[model samples]
Every structure is written in C-alpha cells, then in structure tokens.
Target chain A: MISKKLAATAVLALSALLAAGCGSTKDAARPAAGGAGAEAGRAGVVLPLLTSPFWQAYNNYVPRMAKELGVETLPTVNSNSDPAQQVTDINNLVTQGVKGIVVSPLDSAAIVAGLRQAENKGIPVVAVDVAPESGKVFMIVRANNRAYGEKACKHIGDQVKKGKVVQIQGDLASVNGRERSEAFNQCMKANYPDIKVLEIPAEWKSDVAAAKLDGLLNANPDVKGIYLQAGGVYLAPTLQTLKSKGMLRPAGDDKHIVIVSNDGIPQEFDAIRKGEIDATVSQPADAYARYGLFYVKAAMEGKTFRPGPTDHDSEIVKLPNGLLEDQLAAPLVTKENVDDKALWGNSVK
Target chain B: MRRLRELALVPALVALIVLGAFVNENFLSYANIISILGSSAALAMVVLAESLILITGKIDLSLESVVGIAPALGALVVIPAASAGFGLELPTAVGLALIVVVGALVGAFNGFLVVKLRLNAFIVSLAMLIVLRGLLVGATKGKTLFDMPEPFFALATTTFLGIPISVWLAAAAFGVAGFFLRYHRLGRALYAIGGNPAAARAAGIRVDRVLLGVFVVAGALSGLGGLIQTGYVGAINANQGANMIFMVMAAAVVGGIAMDGGRGTMSGALTGVLLLGVVTNLLTLAQVSSFWIQSIQGAIILVALMIARVTTGRAQE
Candidate 1:
C-alpha cells in the first residue's frame, strides 16, 4: 500500500512539473515587436480530433493559413472529440494568453463551459463547422449543412426514384446532425415520394454505423441507396459492408446501390472517380481554414459584420436571431468533376 | 447469493419485454428478437470474460482494447501491400492465428505485470488499455480496414439452424466457461485464490499460475469478442470497442459479481447482459430521445445494482 501510494504520488508530481514547464515555455515565447505579420498576433485553435479526414483538413489547414497571415500559431490542440478535454484545452489556451481562439466544438451543449471561459477572458472566438448551442461567438464560418443534405437527397432521389433509402446519422447532439437528418427526410418525402427513408442513428462512430448498416442491408436486400451524413467515418465501413455483401460496383453493375455521402474526403474522391460510388457533397476546406481565421482576426481587430447575402466578398446569412453567419455553399462532386484542383480531396494528397 | 436473487433477473427481463411490446408491437416479433440476440453477442462475450476475471478478485480494464487490437492485427496482416498496408497478405488461417497470438501476448503481458511483478491488477490493466488503444490508432492511422478476407466475416454473416453463428459463439463461450468453473480443478482454484490468495497458496494451490491462466482465458475470450464485433460490423475500425469497458463491468456488477472478488455466477452475468441489451433495444425502439440514452442506461445500471446489493445483503456501492 505504501509503495502504491508512492508510485501514484510520483506520477502526479511528474505531471505537475511537465505542465509547469509547458506554461513557462509558452510565456517565454512572446516574439519580439514589429516582426513581419506579427501584427496578427499569436492565436490558438482547439479542434475536436484528427480521426476523420474532414477534421484532419481543418487541423492541417489552420496552421498553414496562420503562417501565411503572419500570425504566430501555437501548436493546434485537439480534444480527441472529448468534451471535457475541450474545456481543458480552451482553459489552457486562455492561460497561455492567445489573442484569439478558433474552436470546433465536439458537442454543442457540452462546450458551453469552454466558450464561457473564452468570453470571460475576452478572447475572440470563431466557431468552425459546428456552432455552439449556448455561449457567444464572435462569428461562425461553416458550410450550409442543410444544403448539403438536400443535395444528397436529390442525388439519391434521382438515381433511385422508388425504393428504400438508408440514412446513417452522425452525432445528433450537434447542429449538423439534426439539420442534415431533418432536411434529408423532408426532401425525400416532398420530392421523392416513392422512396421510403429508414433512419439509423450511428452517432459518428464507424463501427456502430457499420454494424447497423450490415443489419439493415441484411433485412432489406433491395435497398436502392444509402445517404451517409459523413463520409470520413462512414465511407470505408459502408463500402466494406457493401463489398462483403457483393453490392459494390459502378453505376449499372450487377448490384449497385446509389451511394451519396457527405464530407468530400480524399478517399471518397478516389472512390468516386474510380466509379466505385456516386457523388459526395464537398464541404469547403477553405471555409474551415481562411474564413475561420478571418473571423477571429476581425473580432480581435474590432470589426463588426452583419447578416446578409454577401459581406465583403464572403457569403453571409442572417440567422433567426439577427446574428450574422458566414455560410459557404457546398458542391456535389462526382467522377465527372473530380479533377477540380480547388477541391479539398485533390489538396489532401 | 441465493437462487431466489438469481431468479429475480427473470422478472426484469420480462418487464423489459413487456415494456418493449407496449412501445412497439413489432418488438416481440421474431425479427426484433433476432436483432437483439445478434447485437448482444459481443457484449455477452465481454461480460463472460469479465465474470472470470472479476470472480478471481481481479479486473482487466484492457479487455476492451484487447477486443480492438486483436482483430486489427488480424486484418493488418492480410492487407495487401499495394494500399499502404503491411503487405503480409497471409492466408485466412494465419490471420486468425495472429489474432489469438496477439490476445495471448496481451494477456501474458497483463499477467506478468500483476502476478510476476505483484502490481495492482486494475492500474496495470488500465495502463495497458491506454497503450493498446494508442497503438491501434497509430497502426491503422484511424482508418477503418475493410480489405480483410471474405472469411473474416463468416462468423457473423453465416447461419446455423436458422440463426446467426455469432449468437452461437456467445452461447458456447458461456456454456464451456460455466462447466469449467463448476468442475475443473484450476477453475475452482480461481475462486479459492480470489477469496484468499495466501490461504489458497498454503493449501498447495498454484495461485499465481491459476490467476495468470484465468487472465489469459479472459483475454482470449475478449479477443474472440473483438473478432466477433469486427465480423458483425463487417469492417475493422481503429475505434472498435472504445468505451466498452464500462458496459462490461456494469453487466458483471449487475449480475451480482462481487467487485472484491470470488463470488459471481455465469448465469447471473449472462442475465445481466441480456437485461441490459433488452433495455437498450427497448429504449431505441420506443424512440426515446438520443441524448437521453446514456442517462437511461446509467439509471438502469444503478437500479439493478441496488436491487442486487439489497438481495445479496451486501453494500456493493
């Protein structure tokens, strides 16, 4: 018992020392005055995780854009999609005294503490991709998730005009999940009346999605199409399940299910161009990168923008509460247009 | 524990069934029962493994990671070199062999730490859990591997006697484990060592060897569970079995497994697995809000724990 206590105490002491070392190093890293692009100041970005390509794009993009903008970017810290870790990271960034913070919350409601901490600290925050359910943000720069859902619905609807369609949901606690699911169901009912949509809530985990998809496929062998809310997690598993069941092919192969998915990941792009699957709604990486940092800089620089169709060459929408939102339009990328140099998929590899 | 306390689980199961039927008329149908049984296979395996370890007065927190890394290593070997894979492309037989080896190796590592080094089983296994999970993420690069051979999924996709083979795997694991626990010398030694290791050792029982073997069997069962989960999902994901430790432990505890050790029945653990599974499916079929599912699960575990503690005449909490 004494030895075990000593071991635990030693580990705790080591951790405290390491944390203190990190704090001192960050404090010592305030660069000299009048450096080029130094006016942009040092900033911190807290992302969810790098598990999916969609998140990896944002994680890789922010640092690159910060370098171009002449701002000193601290090493991007991810919560690994844990809400508690997100709160800790945000608190650490605040302690580090970053001029601005760009955050993509893992959960809308669970992120209130971190956002409130930033608000208390007077650090400008830009919410990327996902908006916080509570707490104030200087601005939100994201794609229109509802718009992406509608496009997926139309793509699958056009291909399979009268059959069962499976819609695999992401984490429904987030704004993206609710919007995409509701929009798709509504669109299918309004336009493709013959299509019967079966909803399976997979909660952003590939294994969960795969198991549910496998079961659904077993029960309904003739299911015509599948709409994956996010491809970064769902794409590989959905493809694998289909392949095991001998259902993967080109547009008119022996058994082909019209696969319309979200998140234009690099692998999905490869799959699309290879004719293994249909189109994917490409959420703009530029929106996550340049636009996210743009809002942080604007908020820190005391620039105020309002809700409108377009604001200073950027698309803007007036939110219900008169809050301004910079929403980018997503495109349906297929094999025909997979070569677009500007697409995030081409940029990844 | 009394047989009456054990028999009490039947009412809980029936209550879930009754509630499920009231919520959705199709819940009692043949198709939904099959779905429930199929989904419970992996969980049942996990609970069975936990029952062994818990009965031995030890806990293996790394069982969940064992489930993930075991199958990942199995699939990684067969992945063709053309797609940034390891390129071994071993035969299906060799791939399955790799999974058992990895599982045994992990179990041996845990046993060495706990028995040989006399470390706390809980802490050692917890660290092993983190390390193995990290290794999985690094090995797979957080990418799901679907390029595994066709036979890898046969355990889940195939049927015998008109039911999924996966369900039979769970049943067989429990049946063999129960019989072994009741009749085998080494298995009986597990109870004696967990109840009092020093006394068991004085009684000429090889306590450490028996305990180590128990962990090994637990690990292999967990590894098999991982394989079953991979087959059921029809894909191998890096994040497989993440956060599964809590569920396994909860089932064991609810089934009247004493956390302190040396007291739990295979049937009780099995009942816990079934009860939890039915409640979850019932909630999902009832269309309860997604956000409340976690809370509801916690509430069910708490309720079951209280009932078990009251019936067993011990303050488990």
Candidate 2:
C-alpha cells in the first residue's frame, strides 16, 4: 500500500510541473505577441549634452522622426557631459535588448570600450552627429563640420582685407571644436595668409568667451576680424564691448569688425540683420534629427553607412568605396540673405 | 541689539539698490528689473529649499542632482506617449506632483542614511549627489529635452501683473515657507533639533522624524525649483543643476543662516539671492567680462559672509 501511494504522488507532481511550464510559456508568449503587434521597434539614442540648443533640437527631432518611422526611440541623455554615462547607457540598452542605438558621444575615444561592449552583445550602434574615435560603428551620420568651417573661413576671408583675425574657438578638447578650428585655421592659412590667426579657447561658454574676448581685445585692439566657431549668443557681449570702446566702426566706410559665427540661432540672425554681426553659418536643426534617424535605421537594418570624410575618420575605418559622402549644405547667411523666412524662422532668439 | 543684527541685511540691500540705481538708469528700467527678478526666482527657490534643510542643521549637497532629475522626470512624464505606456497622462500639475514625489523619495533615502543609519549628513548627501547625477546622465544619454508645449514654456517667460510668473511663484514659495518656519510645530521642532539634537530628543521630540521631514520638504521645494528652471530655459539638459550647489549655499550663508544651523530667516535668504542678482545685473550693465563676474561674485559672497560673521560676533560680545 505504501509503494502504491509513492508512485501516485510522483505522477501527480509530474503533471503539476508540466502544467506550470505550460502556464509560464503562455504568459511569456502573450507579451511577446502584444509587443510585436504594437508596430514599434525600441531604439536607444545617446547625446553629448542635453542643455545645448543644438542637442536639444536634435533630441526633439529624433523622437518625432522615430515615431514617423514606427519606431520608439528611447533617448538617454547625460547632464554632466561625461562619457562614462554614455558607456553605462549603452550597456543598459544592450541589457534591455534594444534593436539599435544612436549615440552623440562626448569623448569619442572613451566610448570605444562601451561601443565594443554593445557590439559584443550583437547590438548595432549608429554614431550620430559625433563619431566615436575607435571601433567600426554600423554607420556614422554627422554634418561636414570641417567643410562648414572652411566655408565660414572663406566667407570671412573674402570680406576682410589684411586685418588681424581672431578665432574664438569652442572647447579645444571637443571633436567638433578641434575639427572646426583646424579646418578654419587651414583655410585661413592657405587662402588668406596675411590674416594673422589668434586662436583663443572659449570652452564653448558664452561667459568664458566674453571674458577671453575682453582680454584679447585689450591685448589686440587693432584686431578687426572675428570668426566664432559656435553660436552668436556669446559674441554679443564682446561686440557690445567693442562698440563701447569705439572699435566697431571701420576707419573707412566699411563694416569695421567683420564678425562671422556658426549655428544660425534666431538671435544671431537678428544680429546679422542689424549689422551687429556679419554672418552665421546655418546649421538646420531638423537636419540633425533627420540624419540621426536615417543612420539609426540603416544600422538596425545592417546596411553599410558612412558620413562625410570631414566628419568621420573614414580612412581609418576602411569604409567600402563608393559610399555617398555626407555633407552639410550649410548656407551662409549674411545681412543680404537674412530675410529668407523659410530657413531663418527656426532660429531661436 | 540682537534684533539689529538680524536686520543687518536690510540696510545693505537698500544701499545696494541705491548704488545700483545711481550707477545706471537702466538698472531701474522695468525690463531689466523684471529680467533680474525672473533669473533670481529659480536660484531663490533653490536657496529656500536649502534653507529648510539648513534650519535642521543638515546639509544637502545632493540638491544639484535633485534639481536635475526632478525636471527630467517631469519631461519624461509630459512626453505624450509616456502617459499612454504608463496608462496615465500626467498634465503639468500631475507631472509636477510626480516630480515632487520622486524628489521626496530621494530625500527620504538620504534621510534614511543620515537619520536611521546614523551617517553624517554631508557625506550621505554627497554620495546621493553623485548617484543622482549619474542617474540623470544615464537617463538622458547626455542629451537635453526640449520642445516642451507652448503652455509649459509660457510658465518660464510669461509675465503676470508686471512681474514674471517665476518671480511670483518664488514669492509665494517664500511666503509659505516663511510662515511654516515661523509658526508650524514641525518647523519649531526642526529648529530645536538644530539647536540641540540630544536635548530635543530628550524633550520628547522625534528628532529623526523631524530631520527626515526637513529633507523631504527641501526635496519637494527643490523639485519645484527644477521645474521652474527647466521652464525658464525652455529646455532640460543634463547640466541643469551644475555649479548651482555653490550658489545656493553661498546665498544661504550670505543671508545670515548659521553654518552650524538653527538660525536664519527666510527673508534673509531672499535678501541674499537679491544681493547676488543685483551684483550680476550691475556687472552685466558694466559690460564686465564673464571671468571677472565669477571672481567678483565669489568676492561678494566672501565679503558678505565676513560682514555677517563680524556683526554676529559683535552682537555676541
């Protein structure tokens, strides 16, 4: 009788185990089916700085474009502008099983390990706006900043005739800053050799630029031309200071101080029109987002992608030949073209 | 004589106003003054929040992180699809509520370490600061959140009755905070704890609970400040609260809040904020370099602290 009872209890336990297994399978399948039916793929995007208007515009556009593409983009932004956070976000995205990732890295070099970590997990990363220093990402989509710099420099060089040019550089350590400064300096040296370049690091801060400019102005009162790599907000105080010091008006009938800036923010545009600023290179806000999404889509689909050589280290990556080069078609806006409402309206004062 | 020492900030404030007015007619202009008040409002709220924690003889070095995370969470909530996922569409009010709740939760966590675990407030808050900063950086992926609805942006730039909405909100916050600090039983308990923790505990006051409550209140106020700051800038970035801790602490100290705690009035904190704002405005008008502005601000804070210390010492003698 005891042997019979033991056999009966074992049979009952086996049936219970099978039922429990079936129940769990159903539970898991239900969510999987539901998730598939939602028609949305999860993508993670990492940006360098959230507070900047450039990044802000980029963040706003990515999600909107992702929605249109029927993908849900989860943007994980770092407030401290730290690369470690970028690595952590990538790892987290990988663990969460995201379909793809788009990152605007703070330090391109520091994020290589993180990108490798993601790649190890079979997750594809799309470097957006800012390319990573090492590793082959699925794709890199960024504006041709060097070309933009060259164009900006050429425009300023064309306007100025034999004057000391002061270049207000962004953060020297930043990839964007370094590339822009290099391109601008190279173009100035090649095309306008007479224009002496006095490069000062502004650290991409308005206040810092203003202070540095003050010292620069004090030292180089005869400096007549200024090329700023960033937006025009920081240049306002400097210009105001110059105006106060009676250095704004040219000795002759000319715009005395030729101020050229990048990032055609609304205030900059307005200043250009008012003759407070000379010109600004228009960096369309929508372009940052649209390009980011395109790269992300290509990455997720395993399609080969590459940005402009000026924007990325293409030769280092040994990209396949015949890839369409990405270029920033940034139109130079001066007082003459400042009234172009279609493009200029997006500028934030 | 003690009352005079408490009122010492008023004469200095008046003198600053007179000096500023004499220096530049634009200083008294409606637009410039409004701008000053608008900018100060956010910092003032931060100071007020810190003041609450200060009164309880504890410091929250994590305030900057609290400021960053709360607004970020608010942004996450207001994202239309976030509501659908969570099955709740948080309106601005609801979003703000969520921010405060999360802030309170973080504050409670800090309080748990300090009050329950018996850790040093400074060290605990500092750790919390780093953790929250990391979380903010991780959550946002180093990007900023913008494109807030027009109504939300209006909260930052809109003017109500010749005053910016932010300034009005700050005033309301200060009034309420001042009333609570002056009259509420819990407020009194906080002061008592700051004055003498052991004596207060012996007198049947739940010292731990009061300290925790102070942190929670401070966190809630900080959450509100974050919302205001995000609105004011029309964007929420990862560095939203970077370098703000120093300003808040300086304002509190300059306002005559004792470092050892158990002292200071809300009005004094406001005075301190106003003084900083005025100095900044003057420098801007003077077209001073940004580098000099920072140095000058540091100097002003030092001078104010020195003056307060001297006055307090004289009063004691």
Candidate topping DockQ: 1
lDDT of each: 0.80, 0.70
Model 2 chain B weakest lDDT span, ten residues long? B80-89
In candidate 1, what are the lDDT values of residues A43-119, reduced to their tens digit? Answer: 78988876666776777788788777656778998788689999999989988878889888888788888887777
TM-score, model 2 to reference: 0.58
Q: Fill in the DockQ of model 1.
A: 0.19
Residue-by-residue lDDT tens digits, candidate 2, B1-317: 64556655666667667877787666777656665676677788889989888888889999888888987876676765531122245676677678788888888888888989999999989988999987886776554555455554455556788676878999998998888878988778878888899999999999988888878878888887887776655556566677789889887877877778788788888888988877766665554543345677677666665666665564311
DockQ measured for candidate 2: 0.09
lDDT string for model 1 (B1-317, tens) is: 45665544666667667877787776777756776777778889988988998888989999999999998988888878654357888888888888878888899889989999999999999999999998998887666676678777777778788667989989998998888888898778878887998999999999888888888888888888888888777667677899889889878877777788887778888988988777766665554555576688678767766666555565552
TM-score list, all predictions: 0.81, 0.58
Q: For residues A258-295, write the lDDT of model 2, one tens digit per residue.
A: 87888776666667767777888887666656666766
User: Candidate 2 lDDT (Cα, whole model)?
Assistant: 0.70
